[model samples]
Target: MAKSTSGLSRKRMGEMYRTMLRIRRFEETADDMYMAGKVVGGVHVSIGQEACSAGVCAALREDDAVLTTHRGHGHSIAKGTRLPEMLAELMGKVTGLCRSKGGSMHIADVSKGHYGAHSIVGANMPMAAGIGLAYQLEGKDRVAVVFFGDGASNNGAFHEAMNLCAIWKLPVVFFCENNQYAVSVPAEYSTSVDDISVRSKGYDAPGLTVDGMDVAAVYEASREAVAHARRGLGPSLVEAKTYRFFGHSRGDPHYGMYRTKEEWEGWKGRDPLIVCEKMLKMTAKQKKAHADAVETEIREAIEFAENSPEPEESVALEDIFA
Candidate 1:
């Protein structure tokens, strides 16, 4: 993408573009694997919402913590989680992030400062707040970032976490990836507010909304939000108005049933990758080069997962608490 004059450097913009492309390709490969019976369990792909995760995570430090929702593969990838391990986890291989136990929804890589991806809606919000509290007590400048959907914004956990984070002046950023759907229900039908960021006001926290499809916009907003938190100014909420180009999950067959074909086409026309390509004025050769590199990486990851051995059956009960 074209480097914003005052914001991201050209190199950083290039990194963002590559990161977004990697997320898109990774999800696409995972979808194909799921359909071919290689990947088991529920698979939620953030195909169209890559920019939000890429931009937000790009603005964070390596030691900063992050909590993500069920649809968090892109988030983990953006936060430095390895693609091979993530894909292996989805395929139930022993080489997976959680030794194939967490599947698609529960991948966690604490080494990268990614707390974990939770399957439960709105569950990670409070967990992120607790992480923030810990950082505060330890006198660290680290910040906690939580990624949730518009649906989760209406959940009680979201309300409670926002209140506590604000009250304690905890360094946290509540990033609501408003993809406009809570499963089959539309946000317009489910949420009373037009913008999810408005809810931040009730907690006395700063709130802002950005065009999630635009990576630069997201990056700018997130940088400011993260900086505010790092300065010990408390929490902020960023509502990214974006769209998912697929069904809520792989198992959900009603992909285009709820929304109109025109709506889908309109959003796809603004595909984040395409937009970034335009901004960068990338040539066909450059685009092909980028695509080829990402495809090779993804193919190698899949091969690694397929070649990895499964966990021994004897160890199945080892991690259980019961």
Candidate 2:
């Protein structure tokens, strides 16, 4: 689908494209399944923010821990979480990542350094600090990345964790996906600063805000932040300015409720997948081929989930407590 490029090899660029597309297709299908009652619980799809997760995780190693928010499927997939396990978790199958317990808002695979995801806004913030502290005390070079939204930045944990990580020089990359809204509330209405990354200045940490729609841009910026942390330079805040094509959640209106049609249309023009294709100069045939592969993978995941067994009623409460 791509030819060799100078900055990033054509192969890696193509991989990123496919990853973004994978996220888009996966979320879309998951949402559909949720509505159809095949999938359990509330589904929050990161359809338009694929570039943010794809690019940031591309800059990370498998051993680096990732702590993400409720809308975390994109980040989990980006970290190489298996599609079957993810779907199983969504479907509440025993073969799921968290053994049918965590579901969509809570999935964790420690073997791959994906610590866990939280439904509470900003909940992962302090956990990111704790994980970073653990790595520091252990003298491990591995870093922790906490993916939060613009809403979480306003949470108290954001301030505490950022301050503590900065003061201690902990290895952490604070990745913020500022998608313009926190539920139905506009970020402009709730946030005091125009750019959330600017808040990093208060803690004397390196901060950068990039275009979340451009996978290449997000990757480059994330690589820089990751490098700074690996060098024991402490936490770095990397914010991606992006948008979500879907509503805040299920039953939420896609338009006329909070976002203007013009705003949504403008963002749609720069959809991450479209941007990736344009940048790579992929042919229509190549685009169609990539899409087919993504669809096939997703279908297989669903099939596996449906066929998998559910957790036994006997052991359902066994893993409830730590």
Candidate 3:
């Protein structure tokens, strides 16, 4: 795991690595809990695609906003959502980020700038467009990023949102986490566009693609794209072509039922954590120490989430509207 020392500070690089590791471990823990029948509902783990989330999020300001997909925990974690609250939301606890109402698909912390995660494909793109519009009208420089899959790129909202964002020069970044599939369907089947990034031109926006497995590459790409939007240069589309080592949700096996064995093995070999570790000039002991500390922190968060009480029966009737 070699650190891209070109343009990042020590603290920034370290934070990026830490965020990637956090996302990886969080999804791993969620997977284990789901298998043990502790976690409820469906979870779209972003195991193999952590670099896309961490890289892009690393470039965002605290005030910038983001919208996520069902496989959104990575973005939430990267955007600074506290783990205990997130886990509690997954467990349906009263203190959960979404107050135990949104569950896995809808878990969001508005205060953290994570607008919300939706299960409906391509639904959030338009919402993100509207949010960007609000920011522009309010005279705020803040930008919004939308995380979606390749299948979502084909949806009508994707086109409509991009059109609106480009028309008004809204500060938005369309981040397509092209993890090769939309659930069980492959991108090849869903799209005729050779590259998702090229589709950005249709909306008169800049489009770029990066190695989604490489966190450094993603961070660099997003930094520039976000900077462009912040300069009021209009929007950009980034296609992070990564892979998923897990199923669409917790119930499916990692071994691909729809994909080939060779494809899975190929992507697994380039594990983001391994790549990051190799780049850093640290001894195995130091690497282990860092990983252990993070694991301990996550363990504590999980414990807190588990011990926390579930939502009160009376809460079921509250927070339904503004």
Report the lDDT tens digits of candidate 3 across residue range 263-293. Answer: 8999999888777766666577877877998
Question: What are the Cα lDDT values of the candidates?
Answer: 0.90, 0.90, 0.87
Report the C-alpha lDDT of model 1 over 46-83, residue by residue, as the tens digit: 99999899999989999999999899999999999999
- Put the candidates in lDDT order, highest first: 1, 2, 3
> Candidate 3, overall lDDT?
0.87
For model 2, residues 58-149, the per-residue Cα lDDT tens digits are: 99999999988789999989998889899999988999998887789998888889988899999899999999999999998989999999
Off by over 4 Å in 2: 1-6
Residue 144 alpha-carbon offset, candidate 3, angstroms: 0.6
Q: Give per-residue lDDT, candidate 3, residue 35.
A: 79
lDDT of 1 at 293: 95
Greater lDDT among 1 and 3 belongs to: 1
The positional error of residue 268 in candidate 1, measured at the CA in angstroms, is 0.6
TM-score of each: 0.96, 0.96, 0.96
